[model samples]
Target: MLSHIDPNNQPTMVDISEKSDSQRQAVAQTLIQLPLALKPYLQGEELILKKGPVIQTAIIAGTMAVKKTSDLIPFCHQIPIESCKFVIEIDSTLKVMITCEVKTSYKTGVEMEALCGASVAALTIYDMCKAVSPQITISQTKLLTKTGGKTNFKRVPQPLYGLVLTGGKSKRMQQDKALLKYYDQPHAKHIFDLLSNYCEYVYLSARREQWCNTELASLPTLVDHDDDLGPLGGILTALETHPEACWLIMACDLAYVNAGTIEKLLENYHDEVVATCYQNPEHGFPEPLCALYTPQALKQFQRAKTAKIYCPVKVLQMSNCYFITPGLAQEIANINTPDEYHQVRHEHH
Candidate 1:
């Protein structure tokens, strides 16, 4: 599983040619326990030793180390560091805390650079204060945070869940749309099974009448609220049910949606935006039925509900959203009428 090793078990540099350039950043921390003999050098927040200002010297050394990290580590890419910063402070427990932050816009991340910078800065501090006592100990060095790679490291992580919206009244179809079998099972079950492959959990949002009256009865279901907000009501119910997890909402009537479409949506997800959706080819607006909604997106929908705006697309337009082009013209198509449903069923088969 290691990227640095090749098939032949020889050490190799990871190929970054296929990776896209992004704004990557990493922060690393190093702790140094100062001996009691060096207490007199601490003048206010500044630590000035006989060799010069200790903090300033360590910062300079760390900056150099950040730029020269490729030389120190064999596998590290020579990243063009855009920014290198340091924060040095002494706590009440006489421990000198050194933190190094590195930023770069490149195909590879700068975590190693940040870690190297903090480590060298700790070493420089030890060298400067060694004249006072050889007991200066470099205690810990670790990466605090990193972003803009394949995955982001954070203190708290959110679980991703799937919500199949099956509560809509199919007035045009004149039948329960969720119960129609498109792929050897109910369409609602098809989408639920699709989502189960990628999400932590998958639930069906259905009306009270459909809860146990159809093929989807055996599945996990969330009864829609009686307020009659349609799909928006089901979305709000799921969000409120599990506020800690992000929801990927899929309409049961989407006949053309496949696993690839869902993968593309999740690949483009960004936490800063309220939602990530596809641009509706027909309307030039966000396709809310097949989109990923974050916890913050729930607030937007709640505000819209209070203002009597029940349209999920309108709510998404009023707030910030990231949109990607649908892979195919039918990727966002949902069958509302019996004619369209029959045509799609024939075409899909």
Candidate 2:
């Protein structure tokens, strides 16, 4: 229904030139809690499913939808996405989660892209599983969270650090964030150094690609690789790779993370604490960029990284983790494009 944005009066993309310049991104996912009858048909032997590989095809379709979200929705702005990634995962009981992340350098937000990716993936599941049973339920198609651009918005994700994913085609960046250097230091190195003091033996997880070389070469680094789940793949691999250790995770894109902020979290950490971040007054939730995780807290989330329930926070919410209180907000600001880098540099200096 026409709830947030007006429809009949006519839909038009809003101009956001007056909008403040800040890192903006959007995350959305759909939950397809399929019935038990459709379980066997959802997953078949081999990466290839009975009709089609559900995760792979859904990802491809989701990415394509992300690129054309403006065309699909009249009010959606046609912004050039810096990166787009989709992940599909299923739990032990066969509940699926599909999550999509859309990043860009633009005047407006990318909620449309995230929603489009989730919606298209859900539709793809419908197309793939119709043969087995028409009983699939594709509800919860909405923007889970969004930040950057005019409004640095967010929704409260769960406190558990079920996954810390870092995957993108990087065709545009011409380099992966993991290997990219800032101040003669690797990007992941920046976060690693920032988080290491907070979490013991912070795991360095990544796909074993040529670009992932430098990041992986470090000794004692945990390898988290699952190509099918995209970025979520990295998170699953992290949990699986270091099943025994407590994990505090962050993305490589965020270059200005403050160690003191994270250290404060470590100072106040409790056994029940799951995630920690500098809370946003506008968003009202712990930011995902800087989060802590425990093993027993979310083992099922790692197992279900390749099905419909692909969002880590969804599993984290269900699993339950405590958020570190007031003092630790604004610690994470992701640097996506040239403009953003310059902006952050200006802000810091």
Error of 2 at 334 (Å): 1.8
Report every candidate's CA lDDT. 0.87, 0.63
Off by over 4 Å in 1: 1-157
Question: Each model's TM-score?
Answer: 0.61, 0.46
For every model shown, the clashing-pair count is: 0, 23
lDDT of 2 by residue, 1-349 (tens): 4533456665444556686544568888787766677655544421245866877888899999999987888667677888898877776455567889988877777888889988998898778777777788887676767887545654432232322335655555556666666656777677666665545455555555434345446534444455655555666667676566565667777666666655555544434334444454556554545666556634656555535676655655555454554443345655667666656557656
Q: What is candidate 1's lDDT per residue for 40-142, written digit by digit as tens?
A: 8898877889899988999999999999999999999999999999999785446787889999999999999999999999999999999889898896687
